[model samples]
Target: MSFEIRIARQFGERTIAAEFASKGGLTALFGPSGAGKTSVLNMVAGLLRPDTGLIAVRGTVLFDASARIDVPARQRRAGYVFQDGRLFPHMRVRDNLVYGWKLAAPVDRWMDLDEAIHFLGIGHLLDRWPRTLSGGEAQRVAIGRALLSAPRFLLMDEPLASLDRARREDIMEVIERLRDELKLPILYVSHDRDEVERLATTIVPIG
Candidate 1:
Protein backbone atom coordinates (compact mmCIF):
# COMPACT_ATOMS: atom_id res chain seq x y z
CA MET A 1 0.00 0.00 0.00
CA SER A 2 1.08 3.59 -0.67
CA PHE A 3 -0.17 7.00 0.41
CA GLU A 4 0.24 10.46 -1.09
CA ILE A 5 -1.13 13.37 0.91
CA ARG A 6 -0.82 17.08 0.31
CA ILE A 7 -3.45 18.92 2.27
CA ALA A 8 -4.07 22.11 4.18
CA ARG A 9 -6.54 22.93 6.93
CA GLN A 10 -7.18 25.87 9.21
CA PHE A 11 -8.23 25.79 12.86
CA GLY A 12 -8.98 29.25 14.17
CA GLU A 13 -5.61 30.92 14.75
CA ARG A 14 -3.56 27.95 13.54
CA THR A 15 -3.22 26.45 10.10
CA ILE A 16 -1.81 23.00 9.34
CA ALA A 17 -0.24 22.20 6.01
CA ALA A 18 1.07 18.70 5.44
CA GLU A 19 2.55 17.09 2.37
CA PHE A 20 4.16 13.70 2.25
CA ALA A 21 3.98 10.22 0.75
CA SER A 22 4.73 6.77 2.08
CA LYS A 23 5.72 3.71 0.10
CA GLY A 24 4.64 1.23 2.81
CA GLY A 25 5.53 -0.20 6.22
CA LEU A 26 4.92 1.69 9.45
CA THR A 27 5.17 5.46 9.09
CA ALA A 28 5.13 7.48 12.27
CA LEU A 29 4.11 11.13 12.45
CA PHE A 30 6.49 12.32 15.11
CA GLY A 31 6.49 15.65 16.89
CA PRO A 32 5.65 17.39 20.11
CA SER A 33 2.09 18.11 21.26
CA GLY A 34 0.06 20.63 19.22
CA ALA A 35 2.09 19.79 16.10
CA GLY A 36 -1.05 18.72 14.20
CA LYS A 37 -0.07 15.07 14.04
CA THR A 38 -3.56 13.91 14.99
CA SER A 39 -5.02 16.47 12.62
CA VAL A 40 -3.16 14.95 9.71
CA LEU A 41 -4.30 11.49 10.70
CA ASN A 42 -7.87 12.73 10.95
CA MET A 43 -7.74 14.11 7.43
CA VAL A 44 -6.27 10.89 6.14
CA ALA A 45 -8.96 8.90 7.89
CA GLY A 46 -11.59 11.19 6.27
CA LEU A 47 -12.84 12.38 9.67
CA LEU A 48 -11.66 15.91 8.84
CA ARG A 49 -11.73 17.59 5.46
CA PRO A 50 -8.80 19.51 4.08
CA ASP A 51 -9.46 22.96 2.75
CA THR A 52 -7.50 22.07 -0.39
CA GLY A 53 -5.31 19.27 -1.62
CA LEU A 54 -5.34 15.63 -2.58
CA ILE A 55 -5.21 12.35 -0.69
CA ALA A 56 -4.67 9.16 -2.58
CA VAL A 57 -3.91 5.65 -1.51
CA ARG A 58 -2.19 3.42 -4.00
CA GLY A 59 -3.75 5.49 -6.86
CA THR A 60 -7.31 5.59 -5.52
CA VAL A 61 -8.17 9.18 -4.88
CA LEU A 62 -9.76 9.44 -1.48
CA PHE A 63 -9.98 13.20 -1.68
CA ASP A 64 -9.21 15.83 -4.28
CA ALA A 65 -10.41 19.41 -3.99
CA SER A 66 -9.51 20.15 -7.61
CA ALA A 67 -11.67 17.32 -8.85
CA ARG A 68 -14.31 17.65 -6.17
CA ILE A 69 -13.78 14.09 -5.04
CA ASP A 70 -14.08 13.12 -1.40
CA VAL A 71 -14.78 9.66 -0.14
CA PRO A 72 -16.64 9.24 3.13
CA ALA A 73 -14.82 7.89 6.18
CA ARG A 74 -16.62 4.53 6.27
CA GLN A 75 -15.77 3.84 2.63
CA ARG A 76 -12.16 4.87 2.93
CA ARG A 77 -11.34 1.42 4.37
CA ALA A 78 -8.90 2.90 6.86
CA GLY A 79 -8.97 1.40 10.34
CA TYR A 80 -8.36 3.89 13.10
CA VAL A 81 -7.14 2.89 16.59
CA PHE A 82 -7.33 5.74 19.05
CA GLN A 83 -5.27 6.15 22.22
CA ASP A 84 -8.22 4.88 24.17
CA GLY A 85 -9.48 1.43 23.18
CA ARG A 86 -13.04 2.75 22.94
CA LEU A 87 -14.53 -0.68 23.21
CA PHE A 88 -18.25 -1.00 23.84
CA PRO A 89 -18.74 -1.42 27.54
CA HIS A 90 -21.90 -3.36 27.03
CA MET A 91 -20.56 -5.86 24.54
CA ARG A 92 -18.40 -8.89 25.00
CA VAL A 93 -14.93 -8.92 23.44
CA ARG A 94 -16.07 -11.17 20.64
CA ASP A 95 -19.10 -9.04 19.92
CA ASN A 96 -17.03 -5.88 19.82
CA LEU A 97 -14.59 -7.46 17.39
CA VAL A 98 -17.35 -8.70 15.11
CA TYR A 99 -19.27 -5.44 15.13
CA GLY A 100 -17.38 -3.90 12.20
CA TRP A 101 -16.63 -7.22 10.62
CA LYS A 102 -20.31 -7.85 10.15
CA LEU A 103 -20.77 -4.58 8.30
CA ALA A 104 -17.69 -4.92 6.11
CA ALA A 105 -18.26 -5.68 2.47
CA PRO A 106 -17.74 -9.29 1.44
CA VAL A 107 -14.91 -8.29 -0.84
CA ASP A 108 -13.28 -6.43 2.03
CA ARG A 109 -13.58 -9.34 4.42
CA TRP A 110 -10.26 -11.12 4.55
CA MET A 111 -9.92 -12.07 8.20
CA ASP A 112 -11.95 -14.83 9.75
CA LEU A 113 -13.12 -15.01 13.36
CA ASP A 114 -10.39 -17.34 14.63
CA GLU A 115 -7.65 -15.50 12.78
CA ALA A 116 -8.42 -12.15 14.36
CA ILE A 117 -8.81 -13.67 17.79
CA HIS A 118 -5.49 -15.51 17.63
CA PHE A 119 -3.65 -12.68 15.96
CA LEU A 120 -4.13 -10.30 18.85
CA GLY A 121 -3.89 -13.06 21.42
CA ILE A 122 -7.35 -12.45 22.78
CA GLY A 123 -8.98 -15.78 22.19
CA HIS A 124 -9.33 -16.48 25.86
CA LEU A 125 -10.92 -13.13 26.55
CA LEU A 126 -13.53 -13.32 23.81
CA ASP A 127 -16.33 -14.08 26.27
CA ARG A 128 -15.28 -11.43 28.74
CA TRP A 129 -16.59 -7.90 28.89
CA PRO A 130 -14.47 -4.87 28.05
CA ARG A 131 -14.41 -3.74 31.66
CA THR A 132 -12.75 -6.95 32.76
CA LEU A 133 -9.75 -6.48 30.53
CA SER A 134 -6.69 -4.50 31.49
CA GLY A 135 -5.45 -1.53 29.52
CA GLY A 136 -3.10 -3.57 27.35
CA GLU A 137 -5.68 -6.27 26.79
CA ALA A 138 -8.25 -3.68 25.84
CA GLN A 139 -5.90 -2.11 23.33
CA ARG A 140 -5.14 -5.49 21.84
CA VAL A 141 -8.83 -6.18 21.48
CA ALA A 142 -9.23 -2.76 19.90
CA ILE A 143 -6.54 -3.56 17.36
CA GLY A 144 -8.15 -6.90 16.68
CA ARG A 145 -11.47 -5.19 16.09
CA ALA A 146 -9.89 -2.88 13.53
CA LEU A 147 -8.09 -5.73 11.83
CA LEU A 148 -11.26 -7.77 11.57
CA SER A 149 -12.74 -4.98 9.47
CA ALA A 150 -10.21 -5.83 6.78
CA PRO A 151 -9.06 -2.23 6.37
CA ARG A 152 -6.75 -1.19 3.57
CA PHE A 153 -4.54 0.51 6.10
CA LEU A 154 -4.33 1.29 9.81
CA LEU A 155 -4.18 4.66 11.55
CA MET A 156 -2.98 4.67 15.14
CA ASP A 157 -3.12 7.85 17.17
CA GLU A 158 -0.82 7.51 20.18
CA PRO A 159 -2.22 4.08 21.03
CA LEU A 160 0.29 3.67 23.81
CA ALA A 161 -0.27 7.03 25.45
CA SER A 162 -2.92 5.70 27.81
CA LEU A 163 -1.01 2.71 29.07
CA ASP A 164 1.55 2.32 31.81
CA ARG A 165 5.20 1.59 30.99
CA ALA A 166 4.80 -2.19 31.14
CA ARG A 167 1.54 -2.05 29.30
CA ARG A 168 3.09 0.24 26.72
CA GLU A 169 5.80 -2.29 26.07
CA ASP A 170 3.24 -5.05 25.82
CA ILE A 171 1.22 -3.24 23.20
CA MET A 172 4.36 -2.17 21.39
CA GLU A 173 5.38 -5.77 20.92
CA VAL A 174 1.93 -6.64 19.61
CA ILE A 175 2.04 -3.67 17.20
CA GLU A 176 5.45 -4.70 15.95
CA ARG A 177 4.19 -8.21 15.41
CA LEU A 178 1.24 -6.87 13.49
CA ARG A 179 3.51 -4.76 11.30
CA ASP A 180 5.67 -7.73 10.45
CA GLU A 181 3.01 -10.41 10.21
CA LEU A 182 0.05 -8.60 8.72
CA LYS A 183 2.11 -6.55 6.27
CA LEU A 184 -0.48 -3.79 6.58
CA PRO A 185 0.78 -0.24 6.18
CA ILE A 186 0.30 1.74 9.36
CA LEU A 187 0.36 5.49 9.91
CA TYR A 188 1.22 5.81 13.58
CA VAL A 189 1.14 9.12 15.39
CA SER A 190 3.22 9.72 18.49
CA HIS A 191 5.55 12.21 20.22
CA ASP A 192 7.65 9.65 21.99
CA ARG A 193 11.03 9.23 20.37
CA ASP A 194 11.67 5.78 21.78
CA GLU A 195 8.36 4.46 20.52
CA VAL A 196 8.98 5.95 17.10
CA GLU A 197 12.49 4.59 16.94
CA ARG A 198 11.33 1.12 17.86
CA LEU A 199 8.14 0.85 15.81
CA ALA A 200 8.46 3.17 12.83
CA THR A 201 10.09 2.16 9.59
CA THR A 202 9.80 5.77 8.42
CA ILE A 203 9.42 8.90 10.50
CA VAL A 204 7.59 11.98 9.28
CA PRO A 205 8.34 14.85 11.58
CA ILE A 206 5.50 17.31 12.12
CA GLY A 207 5.66 20.88 13.40
Candidate 2:
Protein backbone atom coordinates (compact mmCIF):
# COMPACT_ATOMS: atom_id res chain seq x y z
CA MET A 1 0.00 0.00 0.00
CA SER A 2 1.34 3.42 -0.88
CA PHE A 3 -0.94 6.00 0.78
CA GLU A 4 -1.75 6.17 4.49
CA ILE A 5 -3.50 9.49 5.21
CA ARG A 6 -5.33 10.78 8.27
CA ILE A 7 -5.24 14.54 8.20
CA ALA A 8 -7.26 17.62 9.14
CA ARG A 9 -6.82 21.36 8.70
CA GLN A 10 -8.79 24.23 10.16
CA PHE A 11 -10.34 27.00 8.08
CA GLY A 12 -11.82 29.20 10.77
CA GLU A 13 -14.95 27.42 12.09
CA ARG A 14 -14.79 24.90 9.26
CA THR A 15 -12.52 21.89 9.52
CA ILE A 16 -11.40 19.89 6.48
CA ALA A 17 -10.16 16.33 6.88
CA ALA A 18 -9.61 13.02 5.09
CA GLU A 19 -8.70 9.59 6.44
CA PHE A 20 -7.91 6.53 4.34
CA ALA A 21 -5.32 3.77 3.88
CA SER A 22 -5.05 2.72 0.28
CA LYS A 23 -4.50 -0.84 -0.99
CA GLY A 24 -2.21 0.63 -3.68
CA GLY A 25 -2.56 1.60 -7.34
CA LEU A 26 -4.66 4.72 -8.11
CA THR A 27 -6.73 6.26 -5.33
CA ALA A 28 -9.42 8.85 -6.02
CA LEU A 29 -10.79 11.53 -3.72
CA PHE A 30 -14.49 11.67 -4.62
CA GLY A 31 -16.64 14.56 -3.46
CA PRO A 32 -18.42 17.84 -4.26
CA SER A 33 -17.13 21.37 -5.00
CA GLY A 34 -16.48 22.63 -1.44
CA ALA A 35 -15.48 19.23 -0.07
CA GLY A 36 -11.77 20.04 0.40
CA LYS A 37 -10.65 17.07 -1.71
CA THR A 38 -7.86 19.18 -3.16
CA SER A 39 -6.84 20.22 0.34
CA VAL A 40 -6.09 16.62 1.22
CA LEU A 41 -3.92 16.31 -1.88
CA ASN A 42 -2.10 19.49 -0.88
CA MET A 43 -1.35 18.07 2.55
CA VAL A 44 0.00 14.85 1.05
CA ALA A 45 2.16 16.77 -1.41
CA GLY A 46 3.59 18.92 1.41
CA LEU A 47 2.05 22.10 -0.06
CA LEU A 48 -0.26 22.67 2.92
CA ARG A 49 0.57 21.85 6.50
CA PRO A 50 -2.04 19.92 8.40
CA ASP A 51 -2.92 21.03 11.89
CA THR A 52 -2.95 17.34 12.93
CA GLY A 53 -2.37 13.75 11.72
CA LEU A 54 0.01 11.76 9.58
CA ILE A 55 0.56 11.65 5.82
CA ALA A 56 2.72 8.82 4.57
CA VAL A 57 3.41 7.40 1.14
CA ARG A 58 4.62 3.84 0.71
CA GLY A 59 6.61 3.49 3.97
CA THR A 60 8.09 6.99 4.07
CA VAL A 61 6.68 9.64 6.32
CA LEU A 62 6.13 13.03 4.72
CA PHE A 63 4.20 14.61 7.59
CA ASP A 64 3.40 13.66 11.16
CA ALA A 65 2.14 16.47 13.35
CA SER A 66 2.70 14.49 16.53
CA ALA A 67 6.30 13.70 15.64
CA ARG A 68 7.05 17.31 14.60
CA ILE A 69 8.11 16.10 11.19
CA ASP A 70 7.33 17.83 7.93
CA VAL A 71 9.18 17.14 4.72
CA PRO A 72 9.64 20.15 2.47
CA ALA A 73 7.58 20.23 -0.74
CA ARG A 74 10.56 19.86 -3.07
CA GLN A 75 11.90 16.87 -1.12
CA ARG A 76 8.49 15.17 -1.24
CA ARG A 77 8.93 14.57 -4.99
CA ALA A 78 5.23 14.63 -5.81
CA GLY A 79 4.27 14.99 -9.46
CA TYR A 80 1.32 17.34 -9.29
CA VAL A 81 -0.79 17.86 -12.42
CA PHE A 82 -3.15 20.73 -11.87
CA GLN A 83 -6.52 21.20 -13.60
CA ASP A 84 -5.28 24.03 -15.81
CA GLY A 85 -1.96 22.33 -16.70
CA ARG A 86 0.00 25.29 -15.32
CA LEU A 87 2.97 25.27 -17.64
CA PHE A 88 5.28 28.26 -17.59
CA PRO A 89 3.98 30.66 -20.25
CA HIS A 90 7.29 32.39 -20.91
CA MET A 91 9.30 29.21 -21.38
CA ARG A 92 9.07 26.91 -24.37
CA VAL A 93 7.91 23.32 -23.96
CA ARG A 94 11.45 21.96 -23.68
CA ASP A 95 12.42 24.41 -20.97
CA ASN A 96 9.27 23.71 -18.95
CA LEU A 97 9.82 19.97 -19.06
CA VAL A 98 13.42 20.19 -17.89
CA TYR A 99 12.67 22.56 -15.00
CA GLY A 100 11.99 19.83 -12.46
CA TRP A 101 14.33 17.32 -14.05
CA LYS A 102 17.22 19.74 -13.58
CA LEU A 103 16.37 20.18 -9.89
CA ALA A 104 16.69 16.42 -9.29
CA ALA A 105 20.01 14.64 -8.98
CA PRO A 106 20.99 12.30 -11.84
CA VAL A 107 20.37 9.27 -9.64
CA ASP A 108 16.98 10.50 -8.41
CA ARG A 109 15.66 11.12 -11.92
CA TRP A 110 14.00 7.83 -12.85
CA MET A 111 13.29 8.74 -16.48
CA ASP A 112 15.41 10.55 -19.02
CA LEU A 113 14.15 13.49 -21.16
CA ASP A 114 13.55 11.47 -24.36
CA GLU A 115 11.71 8.77 -22.47
CA ALA A 116 9.19 11.13 -20.85
CA ILE A 117 8.41 12.91 -24.10
CA HIS A 118 7.88 9.58 -25.84
CA PHE A 119 5.70 8.15 -23.09
CA LEU A 120 3.45 11.21 -22.77
CA GLY A 121 3.36 11.60 -26.59
CA ILE A 122 4.55 15.19 -26.38
CA GLY A 123 7.52 14.89 -28.72
CA HIS A 124 6.09 17.33 -31.24
CA LEU A 125 5.15 19.98 -28.69
CA LEU A 126 8.70 20.38 -27.45
CA ASP A 127 9.16 23.63 -29.36
CA ARG A 128 5.62 24.96 -29.27
CA TRP A 129 4.52 27.71 -26.90
CA PRO A 130 1.84 26.98 -24.27
CA ARG A 131 -0.56 29.40 -25.98
CA THR A 132 -0.34 27.49 -29.25
CA LEU A 133 -1.15 24.12 -27.73
CA SER A 134 -4.68 22.81 -27.35
CA GLY A 135 -6.18 21.91 -23.99
CA GLY A 136 -5.24 18.28 -24.37
CA GLU A 137 -1.76 19.14 -25.54
CA ALA A 138 -1.15 21.36 -22.52
CA GLN A 139 -2.27 18.63 -20.16
CA ARG A 140 -0.01 16.14 -21.89
CA VAL A 141 2.90 18.50 -21.46
CA ALA A 142 1.96 18.87 -17.80
CA ILE A 143 2.09 15.10 -17.29
CA GLY A 144 5.38 14.95 -19.12
CA ARG A 145 6.79 17.58 -16.78
CA ALA A 146 5.60 15.56 -13.78
CA LEU A 147 7.17 12.35 -15.10
CA LEU A 148 10.44 14.11 -15.82
CA SER A 149 10.40 15.29 -12.21
CA ALA A 150 10.98 11.68 -11.11
CA PRO A 151 8.20 11.66 -8.61
CA ARG A 152 7.65 8.75 -6.21
CA PHE A 153 3.91 9.49 -6.18
CA LEU A 154 1.38 11.50 -8.18
CA LEU A 155 -1.32 14.01 -7.24
CA MET A 156 -3.76 14.86 -10.02
CA ASP A 157 -6.31 17.54 -9.18
CA GLU A 158 -9.25 17.14 -11.57
CA PRO A 159 -7.08 16.55 -14.59
CA LEU A 160 -10.01 16.25 -16.96
CA ALA A 161 -12.15 19.06 -15.59
CA SER A 162 -11.41 21.64 -18.26
CA LEU A 163 -11.53 19.45 -21.37
CA ASP A 164 -14.28 18.56 -23.78
CA ARG A 165 -15.45 14.93 -23.92
CA ALA A 166 -13.15 14.07 -26.79
CA ARG A 167 -10.17 15.77 -25.20
CA ARG A 168 -11.04 14.22 -21.85
CA GLU A 169 -10.98 10.77 -23.44
CA ASP A 170 -7.56 11.46 -24.87
CA ILE A 171 -6.16 12.42 -21.45
CA MET A 172 -7.97 9.48 -19.87
CA GLU A 173 -6.14 7.05 -22.12
CA VAL A 174 -2.83 8.58 -21.09
CA ILE A 175 -3.80 8.36 -17.42
CA GLU A 176 -4.78 4.69 -17.86
CA ARG A 177 -1.36 3.95 -19.23
CA LEU A 178 0.24 5.71 -16.28
CA ARG A 179 -1.99 3.86 -13.84
CA ASP A 180 -1.13 0.47 -15.37
CA GLU A 181 2.44 0.80 -16.60
CA LEU A 182 4.15 3.37 -14.38
CA LYS A 183 2.90 1.60 -11.22
CA LEU A 184 3.23 4.84 -9.25
CA PRO A 185 0.70 5.45 -6.53
CA ILE A 186 -1.63 8.21 -7.82
CA LEU A 187 -3.94 10.34 -5.72
CA TYR A 188 -6.58 11.69 -8.10
CA VAL A 189 -9.15 14.34 -7.17
CA SER A 190 -12.47 14.54 -8.99
CA HIS A 191 -16.15 15.27 -8.54
CA ASP A 192 -17.22 13.33 -11.60
CA ARG A 193 -18.61 9.91 -10.84
CA ASP A 194 -17.78 8.40 -14.23
CA GLU A 195 -14.20 9.60 -14.10
CA VAL A 196 -13.67 8.12 -10.63
CA GLU A 197 -15.24 4.77 -11.56
CA ARG A 198 -13.12 4.44 -14.67
CA LEU A 199 -9.72 5.46 -13.22
CA ALA A 200 -9.58 4.78 -9.50
CA THR A 201 -8.74 1.41 -7.96
CA THR A 202 -9.80 2.68 -4.54
CA ILE A 203 -12.29 5.43 -3.75
CA VAL A 204 -12.05 7.74 -0.72
CA PRO A 205 -15.01 10.01 -0.21
CA ILE A 206 -14.50 13.58 1.11
CA GLY A 207 -16.75 16.46 2.05
Candidate 3:
Protein backbone atom coordinates (compact mmCIF):
# COMPACT_ATOMS: atom_id res chain seq x y z
CA MET A 1 0.00 0.00 0.00
CA SER A 2 1.05 3.61 -0.51
CA PHE A 3 1.29 6.34 2.13
CA GLU A 4 1.17 10.06 1.41
CA ILE A 5 1.82 12.99 3.76
CA ARG A 6 2.17 16.71 3.18
CA ILE A 7 1.80 18.76 6.33
CA ALA A 8 3.14 21.66 8.34
CA ARG A 9 2.89 22.57 12.00
CA GLN A 10 4.28 25.37 14.17
CA PHE A 11 5.55 25.05 17.70
CA GLY A 12 5.74 28.61 18.99
CA GLU A 13 9.21 29.66 17.86
CA ARG A 14 9.69 26.79 15.40
CA THR A 15 7.60 26.00 12.35
CA ILE A 16 7.98 22.43 11.13
CA ALA A 17 7.13 21.76 7.51
CA ALA A 18 7.35 18.45 5.71
CA GLU A 19 5.99 16.86 2.54
CA PHE A 20 6.59 13.40 1.18
CA ALA A 21 4.91 10.24 -0.10
CA SER A 22 6.19 6.71 0.16
CA LYS A 23 5.14 3.37 -1.30
CA GLY A 24 5.43 0.00 0.38
CA GLY A 25 8.56 -0.69 2.45
CA LEU A 26 10.45 1.29 5.08
CA THR A 27 10.52 5.07 4.78
CA ALA A 28 12.98 6.77 7.09
CA LEU A 29 12.63 10.38 8.22
CA PHE A 30 16.24 11.37 8.62
CA GLY A 31 17.31 14.59 10.32
CA PRO A 32 18.95 16.17 13.33
CA SER A 33 17.34 16.60 16.74
CA GLY A 34 15.65 19.92 16.07
CA ALA A 35 14.56 18.84 12.61
CA GLY A 36 10.90 17.80 12.95
CA LYS A 37 11.05 14.10 12.29
CA THR A 38 9.10 13.23 15.41
CA SER A 39 6.75 16.16 14.87
CA VAL A 40 5.93 14.93 11.39
CA LEU A 41 5.37 11.45 12.77
CA ASN A 42 3.10 12.84 15.50
CA MET A 43 1.00 14.62 12.90
CA VAL A 44 0.71 11.47 10.85
CA ALA A 45 -0.30 9.53 13.96
CA GLY A 46 -3.12 12.06 14.58
CA LEU A 47 -1.52 13.24 17.82
CA LEU A 48 -0.94 16.71 16.32
CA ARG A 49 -2.91 18.71 13.81
CA PRO A 50 -1.12 20.40 10.95
CA ASP A 51 -1.74 24.01 10.03
CA THR A 52 -2.68 22.90 6.51
CA GLY A 53 -2.02 19.71 4.58
CA LEU A 54 -3.30 16.28 3.62
CA ILE A 55 -2.45 12.76 4.71
CA ALA A 56 -3.65 9.61 3.04
CA VAL A 57 -3.01 5.91 3.05
CA ARG A 58 -3.92 3.91 -0.03
CA GLY A 59 -6.07 6.85 -1.14
CA THR A 60 -7.97 6.87 2.17
CA VAL A 61 -7.86 10.42 3.43
CA LEU A 62 -6.68 10.50 7.00
CA PHE A 63 -6.34 14.24 7.38
CA ASP A 64 -7.39 17.00 5.04
CA ALA A 65 -7.29 20.44 6.54
CA SER A 66 -9.02 21.95 3.51
CA ALA A 67 -11.92 19.58 4.07
CA ARG A 68 -11.65 19.83 7.87
CA ILE A 69 -11.31 16.07 8.10
CA ASP A 70 -9.08 14.75 10.82
CA VAL A 71 -9.36 11.15 11.82
CA PRO A 72 -8.99 10.36 15.49
CA ALA A 73 -5.83 8.55 16.54
CA ARG A 74 -7.59 5.39 17.73
CA GLN A 75 -9.56 5.15 14.48
CA ARG A 76 -6.54 5.76 12.27
CA ARG A 77 -5.43 2.15 12.77
CA ALA A 78 -1.82 3.22 12.75
CA GLY A 79 0.30 1.21 15.16
CA TYR A 80 2.94 3.22 17.00
CA VAL A 81 6.10 1.77 18.57
CA PHE A 82 7.84 4.35 20.69
CA GLN A 83 11.49 4.38 21.77
CA ASP A 84 10.35 2.98 25.07
CA GLY A 85 8.45 -0.33 24.88
CA ARG A 86 5.52 1.15 26.83
CA LEU A 87 4.35 -2.31 27.89
CA PHE A 88 2.10 -2.64 30.94
CA PRO A 89 4.38 -3.33 33.89
CA HIS A 90 1.94 -5.67 35.58
CA MET A 91 1.20 -7.82 32.56
CA ARG A 92 2.99 -10.77 31.10
CA VAL A 93 4.59 -10.52 27.64
CA ARG A 94 1.71 -12.38 26.01
CA ASP A 95 -0.81 -10.11 27.69
CA ASN A 96 1.00 -7.04 26.44
CA LEU A 97 1.03 -8.40 22.91
CA VAL A 98 -2.63 -9.29 22.94
CA TYR A 99 -3.78 -6.06 24.58
CA GLY A 100 -4.15 -4.25 21.28
CA TRP A 101 -5.30 -7.36 19.50
CA LYS A 102 -8.23 -7.57 21.87
CA LEU A 103 -9.20 -3.98 21.15
CA ALA A 104 -8.90 -4.23 17.39
CA ALA A 105 -11.95 -4.92 15.33
CA PRO A 106 -12.08 -8.42 13.90
CA VAL A 107 -12.37 -7.12 10.33
CA ASP A 108 -9.19 -5.09 10.85
CA ARG A 109 -7.23 -7.92 12.41
CA TRP A 110 -4.46 -9.19 10.12
CA MET A 111 -1.88 -11.06 12.17
CA ASP A 112 -2.74 -13.69 14.74
CA LEU A 113 -1.05 -14.37 18.07
CA ASP A 114 1.13 -17.22 16.79
CA GLU A 115 2.17 -15.25 13.73
CA ALA A 116 3.08 -12.18 15.76
CA ILE A 117 5.04 -14.17 18.25
CA HIS A 118 6.92 -15.96 15.49
CA PHE A 119 7.55 -12.79 13.49
CA LEU A 120 9.26 -10.99 16.37
CA GLY A 121 10.85 -14.09 17.88
CA ILE A 122 9.10 -13.50 21.18
CA GLY A 123 7.68 -16.97 21.70
CA HIS A 124 10.10 -17.71 24.46
CA LEU A 125 9.29 -14.54 26.31
CA LEU A 126 5.51 -15.02 26.25
CA ASP A 127 5.24 -15.92 29.91
CA ARG A 128 7.86 -13.47 31.14
CA TRP A 129 7.17 -9.99 32.49
CA PRO A 130 8.11 -6.74 30.76
CA ARG A 131 10.51 -5.82 33.56
CA THR A 132 12.58 -8.90 32.82
CA LEU A 133 13.16 -8.10 29.15
CA SER A 134 16.28 -6.52 27.78
CA GLY A 135 16.08 -3.42 25.61
CA GLY A 136 16.06 -5.48 22.43
CA GLU A 137 13.59 -8.03 23.75
CA ALA A 138 11.19 -5.37 24.99
CA GLN A 139 11.33 -3.60 21.65
CA ARG A 140 10.59 -6.86 19.88
CA VAL A 141 7.52 -7.41 22.02
CA ALA A 142 6.47 -3.84 21.36
CA ILE A 143 6.69 -4.42 17.64
CA GLY A 144 4.67 -7.61 17.91
CA ARG A 145 2.06 -5.83 19.97
CA ALA A 146 1.68 -3.15 17.33
CA LEU A 147 1.45 -5.72 14.57
CA LEU A 148 -1.32 -7.57 16.37
CA SER A 149 -3.39 -4.38 16.29
CA ALA A 150 -3.66 -4.69 12.50
CA PRO A 151 -2.41 -1.18 11.80
CA ARG A 152 -2.64 0.35 8.38
CA PHE A 153 1.01 1.22 8.78
CA LEU A 154 3.64 1.30 11.50
CA LEU A 155 5.17 4.42 13.05
CA MET A 156 8.44 3.97 14.85
CA ASP A 157 10.17 6.86 16.59
CA GLU A 158 13.82 6.24 17.40
CA PRO A 159 13.09 2.72 18.59
CA LEU A 160 16.75 1.83 18.97
CA ALA A 161 18.02 5.05 20.50
CA SER A 162 17.92 3.76 24.05
CA LEU A 163 19.85 0.58 23.30
CA ASP A 164 23.57 -0.09 23.45
CA ARG A 165 25.56 -1.00 20.34
CA ALA A 166 24.96 -4.74 20.62
CA ARG A 167 21.31 -4.32 21.50
CA ARG A 168 20.86 -1.87 18.66
CA GLU A 169 22.27 -4.39 16.22
CA ASP A 170 20.01 -7.06 17.60
CA ILE A 171 16.92 -4.94 17.14
CA MET A 172 18.10 -3.80 13.73
CA GLU A 173 18.09 -7.39 12.56
CA VAL A 174 14.51 -7.81 13.69
CA ILE A 175 13.52 -4.61 11.87
CA GLU A 176 15.20 -5.81 8.73
CA ARG A 177 13.34 -9.09 8.93
CA LEU A 178 10.08 -7.26 9.35
CA ARG A 179 10.79 -5.14 6.30
CA ASP A 180 11.82 -8.09 4.17
CA GLU A 181 9.28 -10.62 5.33
CA LEU A 182 6.17 -8.71 6.33
CA LYS A 183 6.37 -6.09 3.58
CA LEU A 184 4.59 -3.73 5.96
CA PRO A 185 5.03 -0.05 5.23
CA ILE A 186 6.99 1.63 8.00
CA LEU A 187 7.61 5.30 8.77
CA TYR A 188 10.75 5.32 10.84
CA VAL A 189 12.00 8.44 12.60
CA SER A 190 15.68 8.58 13.37
CA HIS A 191 18.70 10.88 13.23
CA ASP A 192 21.24 8.12 12.80
CA ARG A 193 22.46 7.85 9.23
CA ASP A 194 23.87 4.36 9.53
CA GLU A 195 20.63 2.97 10.89
CA VAL A 196 18.64 4.69 8.17
CA GLU A 197 20.97 3.43 5.48
CA ARG A 198 20.60 -0.12 6.64
CA LEU A 199 16.84 -0.11 7.26
CA ALA A 200 15.14 2.36 4.94
CA THR A 201 13.95 1.72 1.43
CA THR A 202 13.09 5.38 0.90
CA ILE A 203 14.85 8.21 2.75
CA VAL A 204 12.85 11.36 3.35
CA PRO A 205 15.24 13.99 4.58
CA ILE A 206 13.82 16.35 7.18
CA GLY A 207 15.07 19.68 8.64
lDDT of 2 by residue, 87-205 (tens): 99999999999999999888988998899988988888899999899999999999999988989999999999989999999999999999999898999999999999999999999
- What does the lDDT come to for candidate 3? 0.90
Q: Candidate 3's residue-wise lDDT over 1-207, tens digit each?
A: 477989988789888998898888999999999798988888989999999999997678999999999999988888899878799999999999999899999998999999888777789999999999988899999999999998988899999999999989988998888788878789999999999999999999999
lDDT of each: 0.91, 0.93, 0.90
* lDDT by residue (tens digit), candidate 1, 64-169: 9999999999999898898888999999999999988998988889898899887777889999999999988999999989988889999999999989999898
lDDT of 2: 0.93
Pairs in steric clash, model 3: none
| TM, every model | 0.96, 0.98, 0.95
lDDT, candidate 1, at 21: 90
Top candidate by lDDT: 2
Model 2 lDDT, residue 203, Cα: 94
Clashes of 1: 0
Q: What is the lDDT of candidate 1?
A: 0.91
Supply the TM-score for candidate 1. Answer: 0.96
